[model samples]
Target: MKTESMSSIPAGNLAERIRRTGASRVVLQIPDGLKREAVPLVLALRAEGIAVAAIAGDPCYGSCDLALDAVALTGADLLVHIGHAPVDERKGVLFEHLPFDFDPAVVAAAVPLLGGPAVGLVTTVQHAHLLDEVAAVLAAHGIVAEVAPGSGRTPFPGQVLGCSYANARALLAPEILYVGTGVFHPIGVQMATGRRVVALDPYTGDAQEVSADRLLRRRFALIERAREAESFGIILSTRSGQARPALAERLAALSEKAVVITMREVTAAEMINFGCGAYVNTACPRLAYDDQVRFPVPLLAPQEFEILCGVRAWEEYEVDEI
Candidate 1:
């Protein structure tokens, strides 16, 4: 497996750039998964005599409160966010990077021969470890395969940032096939590739063919219905809405006229970017949970959302249905 820096980002220079911008007290926020790479960067800033602090947690992709607390505590003039871009409304200098690299050999191996002239490849961060191997397999099979860059991970991949497979896919025209472990990767790949795809599980090396036309049709229908609905709110929660009963009840009632989804289902950053008019969360009461991310629309508790949607009061709604 060949590992290379995914982003052409200059290191050590960020602190200098901030200094030039007259910014001091830099707070570096990184995902819990990327601590190994993030730590050294933080220390480097400190070595440069720049005030720096590191926070360990998910950053909820800039939606968690701990992220907000880190910003407030550090009083950071510049926020060097590693792994993720800034999702919060708070304005500051933000630096982002794609922490994982695709193995070239994996990318070479996974192309399929039966799919005619060319193929499309897609995978996630977890399966990205196998890209080179998959690539090698493709080359050996005498099949031309292309990978798309920046299709996954926030900011709409190619539009705002670059993703590995997405970059490759854009560069080459091929029949699309995704090398992935689960539904999400193949689904996303199909959405981006605009082709029927073969999904491969990197761990087990198992493969399956997937069709996205049906799924996309369903999703589009749902989105259209939701958009036209008189009212809409989402029930926000982590994993599931297991913790809050009142919130769930209110959400169910609100759903009659409005669309409701979980926080896990929709990122706060996405909500803000999508321009959703209203949202009622059952999870963390704060908009964007921890406050690292902010919502532009009106965010209220489930009860408030129900009222806005003109649904029955929380007590009048059936808790069991929630």
Candidate 2:
């Protein structure tokens, strides 16, 4: 519930955008971590004579998890999705970029640990605005930090998402410096680019070199266990942005035992009900890599499934991205 160092959440652009949309009923949806700002956001919107239909209370992981069902239930004309950029140009949904402030000088703490003269810089959306300052800080230490142009799910240069690391892979830098909260992103960057990665927690001032060896070992074990399965449930996301129908179809064709299963939220219970001996997650890449312990069976990434099916070799191991 603590907002930490952030003083006030800005509503300047939000109100104007809402007015432009001419929406009478709006459903405000925000990520779970920023749900605290919903009340103030609703107040500001209502103050402008915009009727708040309802707040999308479901857990929002990213812009991909648009609260369309909630918007429909409330008969909202517009959905104000906060904290992420648009993954898809879905009608009736507006994405508001939420910026968080942090000192760029924190990059200095990570500079000395960077082993390369030139490094790729990547961060989550919250701190992506500070990339210019971060690059300058790295330059002060004679380190060149290259922030590659963002594409796919990430819309800003140097910005990375848990499900997308296109910005990091674009740079092809020998080493990557990720200024973000968790080790998950940095680890994903390493796997996505096959480069050395260092994660710097801007708030805590903690930096560490990341390795995919541990995750690889764990995935290898899962693949081995999954081989024992009689059937595979190919998880296809029903979310507006996370859905990869074509990829799911391709993966399903790989094995006769595989069948496509669609769900809004991929959970252990759903996987259990499907009664598949194993699952291949084609949804958010994190569900397989990060949430494996929470899964009832081996939840493999698409590439991992290919490996299990003998189409791809273990040496060709790659991280799944939208």
Candidate 3:
């Protein structure tokens, strides 16, 4: 789809860059959305006289989930990771972030929802490139958007991830403007900062105020139901950037009924198989918040588990972040 990035090689120079890597064989990884282009992508490299050893078939949610094992088995010298920005540095892995472009002026739809003269602006990696343009659009509408730099995990200024909202909280503005697709990010920001947030869908020009009230209500009820559980399985992810061993261990230590369980993928089937009545997810924080419906049992976030154990009060509630 005519992508443009130094890391994300356009078809014109795809072969040349692979040759520059000095690798005899390469392993390619693409996110689920771009998997359909796998054949053409491989063909393009082959036409350029590049040796593509493999295309990793597993679901790649982000650069956080690396296919190192695929590279190791295929004896490939380099890994072409697509569709995400680098969350951490790892040798032999090249991050090719695919940025989604849209008319920045579409952010004007949020102007009506913002309260103050200024607001904090943040977005996911796909839309991070348009942050400055989005700010300019807001500024023209008598609304100044503060585009703050994010943590190392999110290198781009004003970018926020599902597990990291440092950029939103860094801004001096009272309210937040999130220019991205999903309500998940804006909802998380609202919960994280307890500040007003308006989510703007850059592509659709749809804007709406974000609230955590509904999510918190559901979680609060789930926490109550979790009390009936005889035991809790604390899930620890093995994904490169998502693994929080210390946090998982600490959560496991909170109660005698809790025990740490290592899992590459926390599926409903696996949870049912583990036989735990409830789970305390320390993996990708989004799993506990976003995909809870897929599981039959209650999956609690680290912060919710704290409230359940009486270590943290409900009044001190906060969203789970890495």
Instruction: Output the number of the TM-score-best candidate.
Output: 3
- Cα lDDT tens digits, model 2, 1-322, are 7553431456666778888987878899988887777887777767767788999998899898899998899998999998898876688888888788899998888877898789999998888899999999899899988898868778889988888888988996799999999889999999989888999999989999989999999999999999999999999999878899999999999999999999888998998898999999988989999999998899999999999999999998988888
How many pairs of residues collide in model 2? 0
Across 138-214, the per-residue lDDT of candidate 1 in tens digits comes to 76777655554544322232221111234434645545655544655455455445566666555455566676556
Whole-model Cα lDDT per candidate? 0.50, 0.89, 0.88
Models 1 onward score TM values of: 0.48, 0.93, 0.94
Which is the winner by lDDT between candidate 2 and candidate 3? 2
Clashing pairs in 3: none
- The regions of model 1 sitting more than 4 angstroms off are 1-22, 36-41, 53-59, 62-69, 85-91, 121-174, 179-183, 191-194, 200-233, 236-322
Model 2: what TM-score? 0.93
- Cα error of candidate 3 at position 6, Å: 21
Ranking of models by TM-score? 3, 2, 1
The regions of model 2 sitting more than 4 angstroms off are 1-8
